[model samples]
Target: MDMEIDLSNLGTVNTMFAALFSKLGVPIKTTISPTVLEEAMNGIVTVRPLPVGTSATGKVDKQCAHFFGVTISEEQAHSGIVVRVTSPAQSKFKLLYFEQEVNGGYGLALQEDSQKTGKVTSAGMYFLHFQVYRMDSTVNALAMAKDPEAAFFKRLEGLQPCEVSALKPGTHIFAVYGDNFFKPASYMIEAMCAKSYEETTERLKEIESKILAKRNDLRQFETEYRKALARFQEVTNRYTQEREAVDDMLRERDNIHCSFTTERTLVNPVGAGCSSSRYTTEHSIPESPENGSLDGRDKSGKKKWFNLNLNRSDKKA
Candidate 1:
């Protein structure tokens, strides 16, 4: 990742070095470039110097300085994702990527800050070294991260994607050298897992609501279909009863005269003007033969059962 790197002195380059070495128990000293100091005070995008002393010291308390107007922006792609690290002020600074090792080793990458100051630029390195790992792991089992010393990058043992659990799960620092000066930088990168179940529950609730609504809609549709089928069956039953009655009346009259059945010829089987309709005259449908008897109503003249009238035959004038 060729991102624009930043190394600010916080205007305490000399004392910071002493504090770092004193903490590390190493008698190491450091130097800063005049240009790097000037750019840092003026809030310009710049790098710090990495002067060296001769002490077998340990790690230093991370100096917290930001690259003026720096940010990491990205774009997801088909193969993977492409990210950019940008700078805001003009001039030159070294940006680095790094990881800490378990065997007390450090990994680093040497790169330059974007030239466009107070603006974004597209010119950065595209490195292929993906992982930084511990010395115990194989090159294939895991990868490691590198130090931000954008000067001379040390090789990483193994590195995992985004998760620092494979290596040391703590803060890692990188030092960037602007030509001659050394500015140590720190990155608060973590490679942990997901947190908080509230978000997952909220998503599940949303899905459940949709499913419930769909189920209710299906039940309502089924109910309507059932009602329509009941009405159709009632009409068919009435039609069959009326036709049978007509056939019985003809047979009864056949004993009186046999020649009339032959002359009628079934009257074309339909269109005899028998009208059918619902009886919605506010009469409740009877539940049973004993529903509206002395058990439901008193000895009053109140209607009890639901009924429909059919005009099948008129007294011929």
Candidate 2:
């Protein structure tokens, strides 16, 4: 059974370094370059002195160095994505020479640093000089090792901030050389990724546009909310006015009913329009003989005659 190793969980710096070196493959003795350099993966390589006639022809080529091939895809190269090559200062890997070289040729030289008080060429300076280069195709490592100073490579431009910010979308080669005093030195190579200024500007513009669109949406939402609130207020006011009007009408109806009840309580039933008993008596029908009146004579014995025929003629008249 093949045991599966989970490289994702190896969190220690030493483990990561070892893993990166393993991924970079074994160090080449005969100049067959490795093509496994990656972003954020720090790897170490030891450089030994080359023979007298190897790559030490010009100011750029060093006697002891290793070549690495880094490829930038079209997607990575878009939006000003940059591949940065840097040596960690704390990695005990003080550089004697670090530069972006041609795939099959000697690398480009840096400007002479007049401030340093030693050998005047760029090779004598123990600092990293970053540059970008373009190759026609993938490097033939064995061919490069045989004729390491060929004329097929072109030095495109020097990279500021130690990165190839705007390199063409293709695979490129770089050289990391140690001190040229025939001494074997161990150096750590750290790769990093960054975005160029143009990319940042474009991203800021995109963010601003999105924010502006959101603000417009919010403004429109506020406008709609205001309109809805106004309509709601108008409806509430109308409902309140209608309710008050209905209450007034109900009160008026109650008052009319109370008035009718009071009128019914005050007036006599026999005289509907009269409030007094006298008026009631004048309008009432004459008492019958059974109710103590024969000829309109009361029980007090006072006799009074009411002619029935005369009352009939009076009613007719």
Using lDDT, give the best candidate's number.
Answer: 2
| TM-score against native, each model | 0.19, 0.23
Model 2 misplaced stretches (Cα beyond 4 Å):
1-62, 81-165, 180-182, 195-317
Q: Count of backbone clashes for each model? A: 35, 0
Residue-level lDDT of model 1, residues 30-140, one tens digit each, is 333445434444534433222111111121123223331112212111112112333232222334444334544433433333233345321222221122111212232
lDDT of 1: 0.34
Give the range of the ten consecutive residues with the poorest summed lDDT in model 2: 151-160
Instruction: List CA RMSD, all candidates.
Output: 28.0, 25.2
Q: In lDDT terms, how accurate is model 2?
A: 0.37
**Candidate 1 wrong stretches, greater than 4 Å:** 1-83, 117-317
Query: Model 1: how far is 267 from its true place, Å?
Result: 99
Residue pairs clashing, model 2: none
Assess each prediction's global lDDT (C-alpha) against the native. 0.34, 0.37
